[model samples]
Target: MSEKSVSTVVIDAPLAEVQAALFEIGSYPEWLSSIKKADVIERDGENRVLKAKLAIDAGMMKDRVTLDYDWSAAPAALSFTMDEADLLTQMDGTYLLKAIDADTTQVTYELTVAVSLPVPSMMITKAQKQTIDAALKELAERVA
Candidate 1:
């Protein structure tokens, strides 16, 4: 696994609204350009996504991946781990949300990804940062 990359952004939305946006995994493709498709495979009792399958196409990386979500820390944090993928060996990520004010929220994204092929550590780190930053930017736009 590569070192985790973290990025933060402030969104012009309430905490609940930001949380709702992140919880709606099926809508990811609409806002996340790298995510070509997102399908919820399973949902918990609370109607939160427990598992999902996502088709991603991000330049050099393209793969269909299934991920298992951990919503135990929800309302503030959402985390996921890769379950199956063609190219990814490990994909663990978390989104942490904090209410900065009634109409503003701070979001922090942390990601660690590893591919099946041999890649340089520096390249992996760079890719991770790029992915995290892009995701955060997209999320902010999505909730705006």
Candidate 2:
């Protein structure tokens, strides 16, 4: 485990719209550059398990993660905790949504990614944070 990175952005869209865009796993690649493919292996209400293969400029990395997503609950927060990965270990993340106004929403993304690659730990953490920030921005634009 290493230092966790958190990135937050405010989107000028309703929570429903934002949630809808986020839940559409198949459209991830359209917004997130790193996500080469995302497959929803299982789903039950607010819980989902997905297998993701991400490709950066260097190469491809794969991970299977289980996420507990809920919008029906108060405060409107979505969170996830991943199982151990073959390449990466102890990867955990959370995304929170809060109503800033009637038409604006606050989005926060938090992740703790343990990199076991040949690269430096700082490099991995920086890349992960950049990816998360970019993804959230793209999602916000879509909802807007």
Candidate 3:
């Protein structure tokens, strides 16, 4: 079965700054522990990554995943879907950013992933939370 998780964090940075850091895929390994490597396969005219390959190691699971990213301009949300992966059958996620004030922003991360191996539901949930928390914590440091 597939599992989904949603978590939010408030970063002490402007929305634009936070968005910039998030979109800097090349620098992901520096901030995101799970991402071992990231390569941009395709980009829009605006130079944003439309397709990319990611190598990740998430403790209990590891996979080389390719994803297609979509961005919304009005509300400033970036969503992605898994295009291919050896271990992952399906995966999708979104980063929704809202400006709390001039210097604070709230980031809501929603993720769903299905792995090839059968893992306990409780373990999956715990892993998801750890992944989200670590990402947000490192991101906050990067932009701060």
TM-score against truth, every candidate: 0.96, 0.77, 0.94
lDDT of 3 by residue, 33-81 (tens): 8999999999888888889999989876589999998875524788899
Per-residue error (Å), model 2, residue 16? 0.9
Ranking by lDDT: 1, 3, 2
Better TM-score candidate (1, 2): 1
The CA lDDT of each predicted structure is 0.91, 0.66, 0.85
- Residue runs of model 2 more than 4 Å from their true location after superposition: 45-75
Q: What ranking emerges by TM-score with the best candidate at the front?
A: 1, 3, 2
Regions of model 1 farther than 4 Å from truth: none
Best by lDDT: 1
**Runs of candidate 3 exceeding 4 Å displacement:** 73-75
Question: Per-residue lDDT of 44-80 in model 1, one digit per residue for the tens?
Answer: 8889999999998866567899999998898889999
Q: Model 3 shows how many backbone clashes? A: 0
lDDT of 2 by residue, 5-112 (tens): 899999999887887777666677777666665566556554543433333231333554434444344346655555444566656667788878889988888877
